[model samples]
Target: MALRTYDEYIESLKAMRPNIYKFDELIEDVTTHPATRNTVVGHGHSFKLSSEPEYKDIFTTTSHLTDEPISRYLSVIQNREDMWANSRLKRRMFQLSGTCTGGRCVGWTSLNSMYATTYDIDQELGTDYHQRLRAWLKDAQRRDITIAGALTDPKGDRTKTPSQQDDPDMNLRIIERRKDGIVVRGAKVMICGVAAANEIFILPGSAYREADKDYALSFVIPRDIENLTIVETRHPSDKREHEEGFDIPVSEGGITQAYLFFEDVFIPNERVFMAGEYKFTKQAVFNFISAYRAAIGGCVAGQGDIKIGAAMLVARANGLHTKVFKDKIIQMQINNETTFGIGIAAAALGKEHPSGTWLCDMTLANVNKVHVATLPYETSRLAQDIAGGIGETGCMPSWKDFQSSRYGHLIEKYLKASSSAESRTRAARLVEWLTIGAGVPGCMHGGGSPDGAKLMIRAFGDLESKVEIARRLAGISEEIPEPGGR
Candidate 1:
């Protein structure tokens, strides 16, 4: 079947009844809830783009599994074109939401990584995980299902492995192995986009030793799984949503981050793609996250574009468009475009995995994430700076107040710069949304934390080769002895 249209996708979400909680109460309907409905609209934008004639090529693709058209989020990268297409689709998704598009990018990256990593594991251990996963992907593509990626562990202690955790529940584990499937217990913290997803894929977050066998569990759980409960994350701005309701200053498009609780949730045997395969866990996590980090460079750069534009608009309205202010605008643009360039460069340098999927260059991918970790934060800082003190002082004025004679003249007299009072207010609102609302944290840690990016740099640094080059250049290289012919 071809991919579902935007309307059809929304209908599917409306049909599912998820057991989700936010703020101390159960969310009755995801489509109407203030905190989650906006995110659903953000996801709808992705489906809308896929159907639009201008975006069809980038957002939709012919599935390798079914040969039918599917969302690019469901397409596996098998060639250079596919790699570029994946990067483009993710950027569009991020721009639509102005935040994370949930778990689409992570799941997309994991598809290729799991295929390649499992192939190597199967070759060494006679396992058939690669085949099982391919079968599942075919089903997912045909059905157009949204799969949430569960990669981060609760990580109860900084210095301990999963096996050494004080509480086993701190690590997701296989509590029972039945003839039908494996039953898992434990929870995943900071899982992205749980409110909007139809299913979840749990993958190991760290390398597993033989002693951590039960910790090496991987499978898919339907959002409606009997024992699963989702507690949506509370952001600092969430209170504003509660106070102001739907018109929460920020855009109607945002993402929902949540913690997932799996209380003895069961996965059918067909869905249990990885079980007690400790050796493959590390490769699975690394391969997936590295590719995802490269994709983040594109998504974060797109969000930066929106933030930078908002700041510039506020600057112009405040009559702060002097050379110094314009120069700051130029700096914002440079920060954004630099991050975007790394994404394209990594895609250009991609190599084929053993399974034939294109793998982005690891070094360039890590470099892209490092920039993502720092540049957006710096850009947001400059944006808040240029926005002046009004961002902090501006009071919420109703449309009635703007139109009334009591305060209309006063607002027009004080708020106007290059435009009317309404325009300046809108600009200020946009700036507030990016600089202090839902956008900044995603910029800082969406791909990974800045420190996580630095860790990758140290882990992947090839300093030994640099040392050898330095020795040779300094005329201190030792000659290697050659074996004499017999």
Candidate 2:
């Protein structure tokens, strides 16, 4: 079968009838629920883009396995060009949506990470996990399924490893190992788009020691599988979606995240990609981080574009588009381009792993993420500065209020700026959503925190080369210690 259309994608989700709960109430239909419907719409847009002629090259790619056109989200990154293409595709999707991509691209990164790791494990241990994953990838491509990448575990204690924790269920673990399959029991927090996704791809969030074998597991399962529950997380201004108005500008096509609970969920052997291979968990995580961070840099830069554009629009509407505001806009552009350029560099510098999957340059990828962690906030600050008090004000007159006979003329007269009252209001709302609402926190910690990126940067940097350069420049002798001498 060919790639599914937008309507087909929606129907496919409706057919799943995932076990989702929001605000302590069971959502009967996620396709129509206010909290999750927008996420489905956001993901549906990607499917639409794949079928358009203009976006065909960016959003669709030929599958190496089936030799058929498949969503780029399911394509393997075979070379540096593919890596660069992944970043460009993510940026284009973000720019079009003006918000998150609803976690549609996560499965692609997970596939690439798992593909490389499984192959390496097989080469070392003579396991057949690589072939198993390849078969699944082919089917996923043919079906064009949306997959949610679940990585973060709800750690009960920050200082303790999974096995060290007093509560064994704090981190996702294999509670029972049967001959036919394994039963996993735990919870994953902040799982983006899980309620709308067709499948969930699980990966270890941290490296595990030998003793933490049960926690060092990875697998995939249907989102609607039994013994699983999804609890949606509330974001700032989320309730605005249920309200009647043009007041909630960003909610038009928003995103959703949730907590995923696995209550002894059964995973057949075919779905189990990694189990008890503790040493490979670290490599799997690093691969995912490199791909995820590079993609995020591009996505965040695209969002920065929207923020800068909105800031300029707001400044113009308020008659504040002067030299000061123009300079601030330029600063925002600089930060955005810096992040976008690093993502491109990381992709261009990618190297092919022995498993034939491409991996981005780790140092540059981490650098890209670190910049994204702070630059978006800086962009938002400049935007709010130009927007004045309007950006900070949360409450605005509803659409009904503007249309009322008693307040229509009053609002029209007072709310008017350099532009129409409606346009000005929309610009302010957009800036508010991009800056203070949902956007900032997502940028700060979406892939990983800035501190985590710094650690990876330190781990991957060429410190020895820098020391040698300094020694040669300063005419200092290089001291070498004898192997046996302390």
**Highest-lDDT candidate:** 2
Task: Judge candidate 1 at residue 143 and give its lDDT.
Answer: 76
Query: Candidate 1, 172: how far from true, in Å?
Result: 0.7
Q: Pairing residues by index, what is the TM-score of model 1?
A: 0.92
The candidate scoring highest on TM-score is 2
Put down candidate 1 lDDT per residue, 1-486, tens digits, no spaces: 568776777777777766889987889878788768877777777677777899999988887777889888877787767876766777777676777776565666666777777788788999878888888889888878776788757879968988888898789999999988898888888877767777787788778999998998777767778998889888656655343322453545777788888889889887776889998888887777667877787777778788777777777887766466877778888988887778778778888877877777767778888888888888888877887765542454655566678877886687777877777777776666766776766666665576777777777777567767887888986843335721
By summed lDDT, which 10 consecutive residues of candidate 1 come out lowest? 241-250
lDDT of 2 by residue, 1-486 (tens): 659988888888889855999889998888898878777777777888887899899888999898999998888898877877787887786776666764677777888899999998899888888998999989888889999897749988989999999999999999999998899999998877776689988888888899999988888888899999989999776655443555344554566778988999999999999989999999999999888888787788888888888888887888764566778888998998988889888988889998889899999999999999889889989988888777764656766777889888899788889998888878887888778775665687788789999999988997767878888889989664447873
Q: What is the lDDT of residue 480 in candidate 1?
A: 37
lDDT per model vs. reference: 0.76, 0.83
| RMSD per model, one decimal | 4.2, 2.2
CA lDDT for candidate 2: 0.83
